[model samples]
Target: MFLTPAERIADYQARGWWEEIGVDALLRQAVAERGATLALVDPLNRKTLDGCAPERLSWNELDARVDAMAAALIALGLERDDVICAQLPNTVDAVILFLAVARLGLIISPIVMQYREHELGHILSLTDARAFVTVPTFHGHDYAAMAAALIAERPGMMLLTMGAAPHGADLRALAASADPASVAPWCAAHPVAGGEVLTICWTSGTEARPKGVPRDHNHWVLNAKVIVWGTGMQPGDVLLNPFPLVNIASIGGLMLPWLEVRGTMVLHHPFDLSVFLKQIEAEHVTYTIAPPAVLTALLKQPQIAASVDLSSLRAIGSGSAPLTPWLIEGWAETHGIEICNIFGSNEGMALMSSPIDVPDRTERAHYFPRFGAEGVDWDSPVSAVMRTRLVDPETGAIITEPGRPGEMHISGGTVISGYWRSPELNGASFDGEWFRTGDLFEIAGDGALSRFYRFVGRSKEIIVRGGVNISPAEIDELLVSLPGVREAASVGIPDSDLGERIAVAVVVDDGITPPDVAAVGAHLAAAGVAVFKRPERLVVLSALPRNAMNKVVRADLRAAVLAALES
Candidate 1:
């Protein structure tokens, strides 16, 4: 199922960015070296995803469970290259299932737990998944019924349930019943190649149907190495992961790195502030990742901040929104914790600003030093692997000047070859050897060794007000600095005269009065924002609507404002 070009693979191997080692080999090495060491801790008790109890596993135990499960899956007629669609939370079972699929040389497609019949149907049909795994009920949704409905339509598909198995096979029973003697030999017989596709992860699908991004073993390994380089994670460092396992943040950023370093991973699902803080203190967590808004929200709540001991934290990674300079600086100045600004995607784009790379907190918030820029080499290993360029969106010419917005194009070992089964998307997404990121950025700094890149805004996300392009990120960044603002999202609303008008939706601190449009305009003016870029309308909400990945959904916000005005 691997689709990477042979020439690209040769280039990556020659540059030492990738090797022939796969994830299964890495896991086996970790088990051999640290068999008795704690490998995973699941504190959520599966209440959010299922009604199962809490789980803890050592390296050896995790390996045994994965082997047993893999053997059971093989007995059920699942073979190498067969797609297993799994919709589970960040639990021990999810991790075990991932490893089992890798061990059996099978392809696993992880679906976010939030997906319902509409999204699941499309994914299952597209992938032709042989086996589907889910919890009977999660967050009050009856997944069994949904699976039953789908399985009825596709009789060839097999269903496997985690907590309760009313419609299909019982996953827990299958694992428990598999004999190790038989399982070990079966796994050994089916050897997995490092270049084979390991998983198919889905995109956010904001504009159209979600596109599947298939990543191979080398892709995951190289990505994990990049994270290890940027964060400087050492062996035995405790990591707390709250991100869903379906995406790159978890699989590449945390899970695969944990395997590389043989560290303990504490998993948390359904992000609760109290639980997150407790886990950090209890697990002696040295690193974790969070959205910028969550980091700021924690700072605003002094009571919560004082309740837990965050002294164990050395660094925190944040992205998915424009980071505020204050939030990054305040954590370092007050708590002695560094915030690493990470910009990544499922397509294999990774840009990071670490404490060693960008020591100044304010600079870390807005700029990422171009990895392979001329004369800008750093100690980071990823810098040697990644290549980046910015091109004028309209003219299709490369941009070199500072402060000129250009769409970013990246090529690297970690980047995916193309979207799964979507030749049209692949055709539109790639330009020669580079993958079009659809992100707008401007080069910054002067000297050759000091060149950096600043995120502008998503090309499609720019608000067009009366023919002038307005960057929503610029407005949101300014608004977030306001005293009472908790979070802000700028979106375009339809107007009678102009095709669109700038509208700002804000979430203010509890008991604080929401700022009106005039007050917001004054603030923007004082900040030196041009008049055309000023927001024309303001709406206050308890919280901004976000997707599972913590990215603000501008389309939803725009629809809400339009509905109110029309009503």
Candidate 2:
């Protein structure tokens, strides 16, 4: 039965299933029911530390802004299904832009600000984006110059610059002037259907090209329901999302859940541990999605412990990386916040979450359910909403029982339909039905999947520098073509800022010593490698790290190379 938005929320609340409704209905309901309440708070501080303060906007204000923006965008020729790429930081504009685009049923393509031409070009080409909304400057560089360059290359695209405008760009001020009264009729005339595509988020990886994953209102809405239920979000709760908006956890777990519940969202431009804790106290934040690193830093800050009041914090949903038990247990002991470890990918969210029915406790083992060959296969019918299986690494044959670890595969409503424009990849990813997750794991006993599955690492030779996939084979081929290199092994070394740094371990032809970083840059530039894929660090080893069969043991090389850098 198709229950109305009110009915769905009422029913779910009554059944203690506060997490089962769609986010679209939830947003619509909030506008109808909680329009007078402050739904989102943007930070007014300069893009720097120490000056952050809350700038609250009520649901009514937000709704009007979104409608006006949607109308202005439509007036500028953005159509229903047309893609609008957003490459801004976490700001009020970013949040409102997404809402405005969704309101009109237009597809939003959000990319991170860090991405230079290489990453940006792929997404622009793939999504066939009709327009791009961005800032004139961020962190120092003139983004206006970048956008102008891109416009010169792709003349068909439109541009909307926030705060400042370059030549041949429409100012975002057009949105501010659009009469809400006029936009109301426009929104009423163009209601978004549940299954219409809402966004196309490009997947981040280091190996192959990025894939554009299309998500509809229904998919996101349902995922919101699940996250709300799983995380125990309340209507008046304040959700602090520290994760980048580019990833699904921020979109599905934080943004959608808060909108679905008519809760308040506290936005910070970027992750600053001390400022985050301070905001938690100042805004009375009730929930947040922070990785373990954020948690660890918060615990170590004496100012956070002494100056802030975190009593209102109820839950902290951590993702983007795995959480160690120490991080979870430490925070639970100190702050009384529940640590729910979520395992997800660019594809979609997978499991190993804490049960919502129970109270938050630090019984370590009870936190993440264990599932593997010893107990039950996670791919069984019980986990029908999301399916997973352990397959033989070599043969790709399904492993039916519980005791063995193999490659993990998933197929469900939440997974992306397929990669954009990659017919060959689409052929390999879909086995007539399931999308291959490309991860390796073991199932556990008690039918609960273990969260501690080993990352045997990428199936391909790609350097995962942070979440960006840099193909080593692609880099190696390029490096060897350079004038004086004998051989090269492209490997990723752990770096504090970038999750990983691509390092080329070169074998110099007998006479040549190690080349400096600048020379390495020249070689990569000459080879025409992507900017992010080029080696940020280089190492000259007498011989390449290899296994008994003479195959380069990239993993061992990465560890050794990183250890040397750290030393």
Q: Which of the numbered candidates is closest to the native, going by highest lDDT? A: 1
Lowest-sum lDDT 10-residue window in model 1: 462-471
Whole-model alpha-carbon lDDT for candidate 1: 0.82
What lDDT does the true structure give each of the candidates?
A: 0.82, 0.67
Per-candidate TM-scores read 0.82, 0.83
The TM-score of candidate 1 is 0.82
The 10-residue segment with the lowest total lDDT in model 2: 364-373
List where candidate 2 sits over 4 angstroms from the true fold.
Answer: 1-24, 44-54, 181-190, 300-304, 355-384, 400-403, 445-487, 494-501, 517-537, 542-567
Query: 60-111 in candidate 2: lDDT tens per residue?
Result: 8888777778778877877767888888777667788888887777888988
